[model samples]
Target: WKQSHDKDNTNRIKNSTENTSTICVSVCVFLQTILVGDSGVGKTSLLVQFDQGKFIPGSFSATVGIGFTNKVVTLDEVKVKLQIWDTAGQERFRSVTHAYYRDAHALLLLYDITNKSSFDNIRAWLTEIHEYTQSDVVIMLLGNKADMSSERAIRREEGERLAREYSVPFMETSAMTGVNVELAFTAVARELQQRSVQQPSEPRFQIHEYIDAQKEKSSCCRVF
Candidate 1:
């Protein structure tokens, strides 16, 4: 049902491998996941920490359009490749980012625990996700910058309560300390993997698009 809009672009995308931004690897399954939140909520940092195993504070610029990266993670002995898309949180980029939701397999919505404004914006982000994404897309909420607990403007109980109200899994993560960074991703990936196992007849991937590789800016390259 997904990728219906871009079926015509598939062949051309597959042929142009040299310019693609995704880390191409042969895997049994692929999952398209996206991270959404207000700016400076540590979305890019979290991705870098999860994908690169280290966090470089202040090294990443706000994603101009989108930031793309992929990693192969093993779950239950099955190799699952996660295509992670990071979107710019600015209002100017909202339209550009909304187009991505339709094809995503899962979404990780992040908020800064230290900034109450970011937490307040979560409702708006969730509204957009519901408006654009499919009904089956897995969703998770994360309160980032947990290392700065002293500066936290939102408490863990508030996060947990909001997650309960929304019925999506929630966790507190610190890109600086690598806390729950991997676990959050693993949980999402596991759900996707299990879904695939259960629905063997459904398409394993939603869409395939290749984004030109660029430094300091992300292009939309999706494997699933």
Candidate 2:
């Protein structure tokens, strides 16, 4: 009778362990979304507002290479952990910034609504995406600072046209007023969730290993 009791107790402990593992896995769906754009387009500000619900003004310095933040959000009854990366916009930092782009589940391509040059540079960003990601990567074009319509240089139609040309989603948003910021991220989360449903076995994350492998290969070739 003692042996039988011991066996039953062990089974209960095993079952409890399995249940705990399942709960941990179910509570968070890891998703990586990257924000990329020209300097001064408020990429950092938008992320700060979304993550903290507070707005900070003034001449903030550009990101050096890449900065990351994590937040948990619920979509369609599933809890998801969003890992957001804000990359530097300077040309000299492109090499370092490109390392953050690989395997990203979604990319937010931001542009200042009041800066025509920033809008024009969207093509360059698209080229970068094409170089590192698959066609399946979710790309969203965001016209930020939409509150400054008086200073707006890129019209809504122009932004929409580019988005259509690239076959990506587009939206106008005001980070300062908290307009459409949540919606933009929600749309990205929804897209990722849909993709996850379609591809159940594959997880969504940045391809850090792939970048590391490429760097190693380049260094080896240089030595040869």
Candidate 3:
């Protein structure tokens, strides 16, 4: 019951599921989601497909430093405005992109199933995420390019195993074919929305507070 349009942000809206729009909803949750991994892992492609409803096919280049777009989604009748950040995956851009992780509530750790190296590098990305986000941050390990079925180097079981080891959720998506694209984003939203429902009386979550709380725990555990 939700769709995305980048160039246009209409004030009025309607939906079969919620019957309300992001612009009109006085009570709505906003989550900052990021897409990160090695370059050419289809992060930008996935965002383009989900945000614009079109695929940018053929030899897509890597993102420069960072890019972002908005998508209004409905999860369990709650309206959510997802600020999805697409980060550059190269080493040089690491410094630039790492700054964006400071406030990310949900992360989309994408890897190319055809590139075993990218699959292997999820650890490095996770390390960076671990440094910036707290335990409350939602991490979803995504094996993208599922449409390249014949060229998959990383099996689904391997991805699942890696996700289990990291205690994160996993899914396979094809930005080219638009497979499971919605689920990838909405699943995270559902979790966030459920947390909000549980703590309806508390103030909206602040990014720094979440980071600081984890930092405090780590400091307390440090051996002096």
Candidate 4:
């Protein structure tokens, strides 16, 4: 009788495990993050580091229009897929690249800390995001090349000021040393997850409109 009872309990446990897996899969959510910045700011390099875990020096080739890769990550016991798009930063590619920005769940705006001009162009990039993406889209400003502090051209205070002005989170990272790169992405994922939980009734299709409306409200407040 004991042997028969043990077999029954084992089968019940197996079934329970399967049911749990099914429930988790049904609730799993995915997000897409687009990385944008002026050319030569290490956008592609940073992505390659995160996605592939390999770095190729002197492998700098201009991204033609848009390139993408996907990664699966687990955050707070939830499995999430991240589809990352690396876009070309050239002026001529703007028209082609606009579509990639539309449906992005988050944006990582990167600039070289060693180059003052790249740091100064943050406003232009923000304008592009506003034009192409919903105003509620999460934006993270990243100062790259943190490994080259000896050659730093842009002060940390300046980057922080702009990030505050735009109401976005900011961080300094080094694709070479791999500093704060992962943390920046994790912060974005957490923000997206929190938003999803708070507004469970909001349909995914209406997210863009919702964000745009928020942006309009913020802009109106600034005017007054």
Q: What is the C-alpha RMSD of each candidate to the true structure, in Å?
A: 10.8, 17.2, 12.2, 15.1
- Candidate with top lDDT is 1
Per-residue alpha-carbon lDDT of candidate 1 for residues 66-85, written as tens digits (9 for 90 to 100): 65686889887888888888
Q: So what's the TM-score on candidate 1?
A: 0.79
The runs of at least 3 residues in candidate 2 whose Cα sits more than 4 Å from the true structure, single-residue gaps closed, are 1-26, 199-224
13-126: candidate 2 lDDT, tens digit per residue: 466446545654765566778899998999999999899887888847988666777777887798877778888899977876676577588899999999999999999889
* lDDT string, candidate 4, 1-224, tens digits: 55664466467546644654554474476787999999899999899878766666888898866776767677778776677888888898887678767888999999999998898888999998999997778899999988888999998888889988987878787777666676667667767876777665765433334333434554322210
lDDT values of the candidates? 0.79, 0.77, 0.77, 0.77
Q: Estimate the TM-score of every prediction.
A: 0.79, 0.76, 0.77, 0.76
TM-score of 2: 0.76
Question: Could you tell me which residue pairs clash in candidate 2?
Answer: none
User: Model 3, stretches more than 4 Å misplaced?
Assistant: 1-27, 199-224
Number of the top candidate by TM-score?
A: 1
